[model samples]
Target: MPFLTDPVLTAGAFAAVPQPEIPTGDGLLLRPWQASDAPAVYAAFQDPLMHRWQLRAADSAHEVRGWIEEWRGEWATARSVQWAVVDAGEGALLGRVALHHIDLVDGVGEIGYWTVPAARGEGVAARGTSALARWALDEAGFGRLELTHALGNGASCRVAAKCGFALEGTKRSAVLYTDGRQDVHLHARVRGD
Candidate 1:
């Protein structure tokens, strides 16, 4: 794919793609994070499921506030794009989906995302991820995209599969999780050859 940055291809009026609000099948909407989201994020972490799947340790509201700020910084600098998820009907904060590690030169990037326990299995991750992947390839002009997860995370594997990522095998000692150096499954989706 030729490397060209078209302002119109982006979702909104920004030099780069303006983060758009994406709605999951189950009525979860993903938009940009705001300072007010800190409270919900802090609360979500208290769920053991969120802690286990999302690799989260204990965090305070202050830290979550700063975390939301950092994600916005990426858009400010044209570095990465993120989407903050909310329950569509209730409008309650849920989780986040992001396409970070962007390399415009090589037309490549990586995807990372996580949702609170209450938000999982509603097809939120798959829909959010597929939307981001299609946008990354068609709008962001990336040639290849990658996603990674620890060996035991079945849910993540399912999400990746739903988004058309091909499993590329395990990387031994690839990631050092809380359990020490752990192997990880690598998945990739490449644009038309």
Candidate 2:
């Protein structure tokens, strides 16, 4: 397939991104979200910290299920691929990770993740994030991956660094939260980096 010398950025024909079960080292696995996990997802999202950084809000199990369905829709449209990070040993949902803002033509995407309260301080986010990054860059053929976090989020910054994302800089008032606009730090990793 070839594009004209100057082509407009259209949605263009896109194949669905694969969503296979990925095994993360140390007994962790990344898999597609299931409707049965709605209650757990809702519980995780109830955390104040999660609400502070992430814009998603699901007050009930029904809403959480809808959000999971939305994730599947996004995946089918080639817009995003989200995975549920689980503990293989316990079969417990530990977190969620996603490769979104997918630009197939440009070979780029952005990563986002959050760990449940019980999974925090256990390296769940870092491990799951790194695993997804490898898959996105190598298997998915993405050339570059970007991760941005609120400047006040130290844990996210540390996770990004651990996953080999270099801190590019801060974007002033880049994110508008419910309270007010907040600055965000941009971190990036290239395919060969």
Compared with the true structure, the alpha-carbon lDDT of candidate 1 equals 0.77
Which lDDT tens digits does candidate 2 get at residues 160-185? 99999999999999989878999999
The residue pairs that clash in candidate 2, if any, are none
The candidate that wins on lDDT is 2
Clashing pairs in 1: none
> What are the clash counts of all predictions, listed in order?
0, 0
Give the range of the ten consecutive residues with the poorest summed lDDT in model 2.
7-16
